[model samples]
Target: MQLQLQTLPKVLSVLVMEDRIDAASAIQFKERLRDLTQEGDQRVVLDLARVQFLDSSGLGAIVAVKKLLGPDRVLELSGLTPTVERVFRLTRMDTIFTIHLTHEAALSDVTGA
Candidate 1:
């Protein structure tokens, strides 16, 4: 997966550009997220606009990232494609993390805009 990391004033956003996030790519994605979060950002947002498919491994990777972020950190999601959104909703992960309609919205929230 191609993971791009961007930083706002208070949030670090990761845009994943790939059709699928499966077992093969989940580890690398998780590492990227970990590295991004380790940069001392308070908020993290994963942008899944280009991801057309997500499996259990992908979901697990996200959950792992959330855990790594811990209670004090904010981990949000944005730009979820329909299929990936369905998985999140089905798994009730939508309630577990903040889900925004767009990256701009997520950034606005973190940046207090």
Candidate 2:
């Protein structure tokens, strides 16, 4: 999987290119997020519109990122595909992170809309 990083005014967005975020890509995904979060943006949003699948590893990666961000930082998720959304729901991660219907919404939420 390839993760594309985009920087917005107060948010750092990550666009995942792979449909499945499994063990194969989890490590790389975490590393990419680590590098991006180093930018120290107050908000971080992951764009999962293109990701059709997310496994336990993917969920773990997200959780790890959230922990790394600490309470002072904000972490949100956006554009979750149905399958991916189901995974989040099943894992009860939906309640743990802020989720938005679109990237714009995530940005707006981060900016305090």
Ten-residue region with minimum lDDT total, candidate 1:
104-113
lDDT of each: 0.83, 0.82
Please give the distance, in angstroms, between residue 106's alpha carbon in candidate 1 and its true position after superposition: 1.1
Predict model 1's lDDT versus the native: 0.83
Question: lDDT tens string, model 1, 33-94?
Answer: 78768868458878888899999999999999999988888788899989999999999998
Deviation of model 1 at 43, angstroms: 0.5
Q: What TM-score does candidate 2 reach?
A: 0.89
**Which run of 10 residues does model 2 get worst, by summed lDDT?**
104-113
What are the TM-scores, per candidate, against the unseen true structure? 0.90, 0.89
- The number of the candidate with the highest lDDT is 1
| Backbone clash numbers for all candidates listed | 0, 0
